[model samples]
Target: MTRRRHPSLWIAMALATSSLSGCRCSEPPAEKEEPAKASPTIQRGDAVLVEPNAGDFFEARVLGLEPAAGIQSLKLQRSDGEITTADAVDVYKLPDESAAAAASKQPGLAPGRLVICEVAHQRWVGCRIKTVSEDGYQIEDFGGEEHRISLKKLMLPSELTRMNLEQRFKIGDRRRAFEREAARAGQPAPPPGFSPGFKERVIAKRGDEWFSAHIVRFHDDGAFRVRWMADDRENDVAKVEVIPEPPYQQPPKRGGFVLLKPNVQSLPWARWRVVSVRPELVLQNAAGEQSQSSRREVVPLDPDVAASDEESP
Candidate 1:
């Protein structure tokens, strides 16, 4: 929904008199100036979803326009024939078919005819039309609810469906672009399922600051085209660099031998045989010397190496 200023207010003015004897009367009595009136975002006959109550939205048609509490309000009728009012900011417009999409429809279907259209996969529903023209057609269902369906859907109902404006920009044609980004950002994809173009936190290489970003496009070589989630700057950033999180590789099992990294003595990384389990790792060298070290110092065990024959089973 588009947001703009509410409607202006009505101000009572003082009586005005023609300037007489070269003297301005009353210095144009002080009056409160009216605020600038915003143009209505939704039109009289637009297809929109209106939120009649908080968190509850309903599909409705704009029947009239009026001012409600110094704001632009719309009179709408729902599919179930309920008439209610809502502010312009609460109206969401459905997507219109692009020029390329309209040309692909089946050849000769006129308005005022009852037709069945595929609303979803393997689902067909009946629709009635108000008027049809080159620009667009107004339509309603049996329940009298209006919708902005693509004209192309009326033709090849099997292969086509109504494309929403929000879906086109956020969820269609660029789904993988978002996934590759979530991978790079070290953020998990939504557990339930994928949401295309959803934003997640990413550390920027520039300042090393964490910022919200998402993929807007994808390169052939598997790089992300990113967009900033920052409200001040919604610019698209190409090829956002992401640092991979360090893999959590566990050390060798306590009963097994392991190697430890060098200590402050500048000693080399050493191979040690695990002698016992404790808060600190107890290790023995091949020389029959035992050393105490932090469990974290042990490196991962080599997959190709077999257990040492020196084990005390």
Candidate 2:
């Protein structure tokens, strides 16, 4: 070190020191990765759990995964005993094997078949598959009278042979037509020949006295036209006049009288004596009371003569 060193010897010593430092600074071994877990697959007869929002989980049988639109649909049994189908997003696969076995043992409708049920007094009757829908078959009671029901109200069918095609087709067509006509009318269905209540009144006048008469013609404006026989008239001819009330009104009272006056000039004779007062007409004698030869002699009371007499009086 005290003596002067060669240039090549100094360079070689520097190189050896750099190589030793590089060998000792290698990277640590990568950490071993844990194996990933696989999601369980859902199968038939599995006890599927549905989590609708944050509520308690509901247990139902796994009918099948029905592919529709962009996702799958899962048919489930409701706690209240009603069978329904819901989206897969609302359901989860259950891990309970015993629950799945119990659910599988329960009888279910065949595919394309549904339980057609007739409910009476809160009891189900006539339950069987009568028709098929795109996803399920219709179940109904073949022993009972046929009825119309919506498709969504039925449970999924497990088989198809139990379906009654004729009855289903007929009922569906009729129901659809009825619905179409009801929608087109836009008004509520009306009972046949519906009628409304109304009021009527009738009033008849004879000379100065007014008589209530029965109404024959009724109008919407609270007016009625009447037809009735004159109480005083002996003739059976019916007298008709438009009155205020119609359809129903009081009849004329008994003992009411009507008078018929003749024009003085139109009379056959000038002076007359009252004879008989029958219902037909007022009979009179055109004669003077002087003598037998003056029977036909009487005084004339024409319009002009009556007017002169009025002036003189």
Backbone clashes per model, in order?
Answer: 0, 24
Per-residue C-alpha lDDT of model 2 across residues 39-99, encoded as one tens digit per residue: 1335556555553422223557766555466445666666567787865544444434443
Instruction: Give the root-mean-square deviation of each candidate in angstroms.
Output: 24.5, 38.8
Candidate 1 per-residue lDDT, tens place, 212-312, comes to: 44555656664555554444244433343432111113444564555454443223334556777666668765444688866445533333322222211
- Worst 10-residue lDDT window for candidate 1 reads 9-18
Candidate 1 — which residues are off by over 4 angstroms? 1-58, 62-70, 81-83, 88-175, 178-247, 250-313
